[model samples]
Target: MSEMCPCGALLGESLMPREMAEEGIFSNLLEILMSASSEIEQACKDSNESVDLDTCLLLTAECFRCLRNACVECAKNQHVMRNLGLISTSVHLIKLLHGIQMKEELLLTALRCSLQFLGNIAAGNRDSQNSIWKCAFPDLFLTCLTYNDEKIVAYCCMILFTCLNSEKVRELLDPGNLTVAFHVLKVYKEQLESEWSFLIVTDHLLKCPELVKALYAKLSNQERVTLLELIMVNVNEKNPVTSEEVNVLMTHADFLAGCFQENCEAVLKLTSAADAEDEEALVTIRLLDVLCEMTSNNGQIEHLQSLPGLLETAIDTLRLTHIAGKQAVNIFTATHAMTGQEEISHPAVGFKSHLIRLIGNLCYKNKKNQDKVYELDGIPLILDNCSIDDNNPFVNQWAVYAIRNLTEHNERNQELIAQMEEKGLADNSALESMGLEIEKRDDKLILRSVRKKPS
Candidate 1:
């Protein structure tokens, strides 16, 4: 034991896990781990020999590590350990150590090792996950989450994330337990190693409609902000973005949009710069992004538009940002003149882009929304937003998209744009600057990129 061989690391990183399991090594390690605490207690009782007790504890910890390594990529070994009852033994060992009045380093190491082994075995083994989860839910996991040790907390999160399933999600949704679950998720959110653990769990919970409504009803405003941010990240990071995924968010679009409506008003009233940092403003920005994602789906867009004043509020927020000169000062104070009283500060940058993006998404292929924008005089405002702003990256592109949608197949909207040009009310400078121009091609106004000039 003086020098643990590096190749020992390769013990569980086995390509021949089935063959290794057949060798009966996992059973032997399980025996060592199960008998460890008893062996140490026997050593202490027979004689006050610290070395003997220490050796027994250390050997047990090693057994935990070896079992963890063995189960890493080997489902067979994970099944073997679960069948051999390592789950209950590890749980008992942890409870025993934690109950000790005098905290010891070896005891802590053993507890951490037990947690790590459990997490490893639960990774993708649904049976093992269900077993450990049964022992952990409502109490053990909550206690682990409160621990000060970062490694212990992270391991606990890892296990929770691995074992999370529909049944556990229902238990987690329990009113008494939901808050604790959110607390654990918040803890996981802060840990660098396990940050995605929060997202994974939140994503799963979000898929449950009951959990979604409960979350909204029970979560405080700040917790709601975090939940919204996690939902945004989860949806955005999904590859090949599926319809089922979009549908989950859409199912709760109205609830989320109601949040957007309330927070949008609070954020838009930011007369002083410091108000931008308030929780309302923070939630507003996240809601904007989340709503933007929701509106991207055609299935969700009509429902979002159908929400009373939702479309109007989006346009109004954009108009107010422009009227207040919020977008310009946020990007650059020197480039655009800002009157002291009219200037507005936002909680974070990219607020305008997300806002514009939501408006654009709401208008996508919906003539009623297209007409609504025209009625609210949002066409010129959106056209004005086509100008590039450093704080709101892609605001220009989103604005162009909005204008395109606003005028598509709608003669009234199209003629209004033509009339804006007649009155010089439209700012085509932003579009022209990007080597694009709006022209009437076959009675349909087309915003086409100029081929002669590079865009």
Candidate 2:
């Protein structure tokens, strides 16, 4: 009873989170803000030359810090603070911070606190969240992210993730915010909070078709590929038909398939400036993973099979290749055989194997893709990979299985393999020349035997 009384309360209860953020506390904070605002305004007018407004910046930052502390747990405090016009004031402070000449410490600190203050005000308050949207906060925060200071960029990620929770914020950011948000997810995902903030926002966007359409229109080719990788990891459907995002994504009309096609071109240009990191194999693997996931559905197989150059891209990726000195080299890549010491197959081998499986899956019941695979010179490549014990054995096993799948009932492919076999004996066959044998399995043309598991 004594503790509940305001006068005789325990110190912990003296200021209910609400009382600690009382109108009087707000008034004092507002006074400090007003003082800092005037000083910043004066400095802005006095200096056209960029010079640090050391005292002015610190005071403005401290004002935001105080308000942030006060509003930490109290929803009404956020409401009251935003109603007091602090949202606009924080925006102005951000503008001032961007404009003023300042030391790195002061500028970074001011930006962090000012943005943090905006985020705090947005907590659980729809009107305050919308207030942030109406202001230039998103654009400003995105701009700060490109400055390449990881800490500062990370704070921007946190702020954007926090404030952009409401539908109002999504309406304003929709497609465009995805570009900034995903860039952070791609580059700074490791640095984000335990929640994986970037992915959370992106997953939300993917669920909304309108949001994804906007994202599709705004992202660059590389960014699109990066986003595609995240999407692949996200839409991990064991039974893909049951998934909403995947179903919605499929409705986008070759949107994802086109992304895969572009990713292949990007990988093919492994030496081009366009593929700076030479992440070709990695991106190639990501595309294959997504395709495999999509093809798992009986409905999606035909759709992916129909994407021109998509299956062909998978076929092209199956070739044994390596990156050497900024050039993509076609190599025997017989790691263990050549080194006289067993070495692991390059990751490209595994990715190539995944591509074979994807194409194989696409051809499951789709004759057009089977024909397309046949036309893409896929027969020779498929047979060449039939018994590769030197590198990854699964590459050989999946290749053999793919050949079986491709030729399951397709007479045209069967005929092509038979002709290739006849030619193999007449001349040094592409298969025999490479020292691989072609065997006829009752109704199938395949390697006599493949290492079913890794060698």
Candidate 3:
């Protein structure tokens, strides 16, 4: 007899973790699924929505029981499941029971597993993602959402939200029919996973003016802050701020300034009322971050400058964070993707850099604010980041820019940098990158990043 092929068991086990396969779970699961296929097929042919449903339900329940294990998700790939002709049946069952559940017991037993099957399959498999997108429409998901079952609704959310990061899957996200996702958020915002899906769904909804304004009013203060932050950061660069939908937040100076001031006050309150690393502090920092980005316009800049002490308050908060720098840096290195991993900017580094940039903007050609920053003892903080810090990779780059901006046309600030340069304290690497040049004019020393050529 010909040798038996090892591909079937090997491919199935490839989906499972090594430890799981060692315990024989993959082989055991395959045996259980294969043993019931004939029964499942026969019962499906015999049963209707009403008559003779028990045998089909029982076989499906057993399959669901097996699929509920963690390894089942790994085995959902077409290449893996095609080993035993299981993928086709699974796909058919998912489509057949898209919105039809016989009873609470039956729904819990079979339908939930089917939805989760589709979801898990789509997670990292582009082909499955494409197929699920083609099969599972907004109307089917709307029906799932409208049902009273939380687990079922959560599964639908999972399945739909799985591939949103993919450009191909984003095409399947119809912005007009996003009420299904909104319904999940409206009902399950407190659930952490649902909030993630909600963010993904509404990210695509930024161009839809009516939904965004309505969502702004519907969500709570904290939720509003969180959602707006997500929207601001993740909107497609090609389409960013193009429509009236997202433009209101970008253009309305009064409201944007209010958000900035309110979040500042909140962060200040957090200093006394809560721990520095608390959730409230994080939220305040994020909102302040959004406001910092919004201050690009002349109108917004005027409103921002009018808020006395807000800029100083932001500087002080950065100083407070500096106190816990060692601990925070340790935490970041342990959790964040490190250098040589990829060229992606570390979030912790970006947050600090953005704060520095905001300070730079505040002091940009605004001599009075430069005086204010100097009075607030911001020079040392800027200088601390001037040298290459092990924890914060981009600090020197932004610090150089901030220092260049702060010292622009200001003799006292220029003197401070000249002293640092004399003492070997300023970042030479940063200066070199900026193309720094120093000039001796009459008796005073002048430092500039880019030299003006004969103009």
Candidate 4:
């Protein structure tokens, strides 16, 4: 047969000579250059037609494996540009990578691999920076935000977030890209409940401080209110634990703080009618805690003025003995102390008892509020309740703490402690067990005790 093509014949006939092929001699002698070149040429011809970009991208990804094998030869001959068609193919693939329906995992893998190769070529070629490929590709990167896949949306957000650091890339992303990113956040917010996705978007927003400020500026009052309401609803929802809820609250903390500072009365108005029967009270309490923490510096004095009554309501709700309501009462107590406000007293004995108990708890459990604890003129009343015979540990523990905190600093407090001690109201064993040591010096009673457990 007119000297069978040496390369194919050599590859085939070498199989018969175990020593030659198996010993790796004939294998080294054979060259598949024409075979690989033919395949690449075919891929290039296909790229010239209006082929499906996804199909072309998949083929090119496979070709990269073959190209890698022939890299030494291709480099020696400087035939790398012969794969210009592959770069063009990547440009087309970038377009197909847009839409919302593409398989996110597959598309992401292909696009990243192709982009890596394109970047490699650009790095290798001196003129590649000025090539049309630069302009042709970034738009596709922007379009990635439109993908319906939350994972892909999160990935695109991360990429955009990183790209913004580059002055050149930042210039390329106009308001349109930002708008697209925000839209993606809105559209896929529900899917972004995962902690990773939430953190990605949150970090992105935080890095772009201008973006957060812009969002604050662009949102109308009603829109801002609605956003807060949505956040509250999500935080209150009985869904599986997700990062999105926590992130939403954390991300919006600054904005909420600003809103409270600007109009505390308005924000407080939203929390006015929390009902004991509503399960959402716990969330309301949490939001209040966040607001309190945010405004700890007394930025919203008027806002805090409205809290004591709510604190009273929360304390009453705790009588149902729900742990959540009790926790809420604890938070409300802290908020009152932070705001330099006292819990408003109810006229009824039962309600007043609850208030006294809450005050006692604060006096004992919260050291930050020690100064504020002295502000409650109800310490003597709390000591009287403690002196009464009650089976409630809540009452007894708080009473001891209130006695300790109240007596720790003042001579007047020491006289009350002595009165309680004379009435046998002070539990000596309990005091000893709690490791509290009280000693009198000159004009003041000293607390020679340290907190064994954190309050």
**Number of the top candidate by lDDT?**
1
Q: Which stretches of candidate 2 lie over 4 Å from their true place?
A: 1-15, 47-59, 104-107, 147-149, 165-197, 204-225, 237-244, 251-253, 259-293, 296-302, 316-329, 332-351, 371-377, 389-393, 407-455
Give per-model TM-scores. 0.77, 0.69, 0.46, 0.38
- Of models 3 and 4, which has the larger TM-score? 3
Model 2 lDDT tens row, 133-205: 7775557766766654565565555556655653633664555556565555455444545243454545455
In the order shown, the candidates' Cα RMSDs to the true structure are 5.9, 7.4, 13.3, 15.0
Q: lDDT values of the candidates?
A: 0.70, 0.61, 0.56, 0.40
Q: What is the C-alpha lDDT profile of model 3 across 125-243, one tens digit per residue?
A: 76666666555566566767766677777777776666454453334345655565466555445555565456454554554444555565556666666665655554323233345
Better of 1 and 2 by TM-score: 1
Cα lDDT for residue 301, model 1?
67
**lDDT for residue 413 in candidate 2, whole number 0-100:** 79
2 or 4: which has the higher TM-score? 2
Backbone clashes, candidate 3 = 0
Worst 10-residue lDDT window, candidate 3: 1-10
What TM-score quantifies how close candidate 2 is to the native fold?
0.69
Query: Could you give the candidate ranking by lDDT, starting with the highest?
Result: 1, 2, 3, 4
For model 1, the local distance difference test gives 0.70
Of 1 and 2, the candidate ranking higher by lDDT: 1
Better of 1 and 4 by lDDT: 1
lDDT of 1 by residue, 206-235 (tens): 777677778767766676777787777766
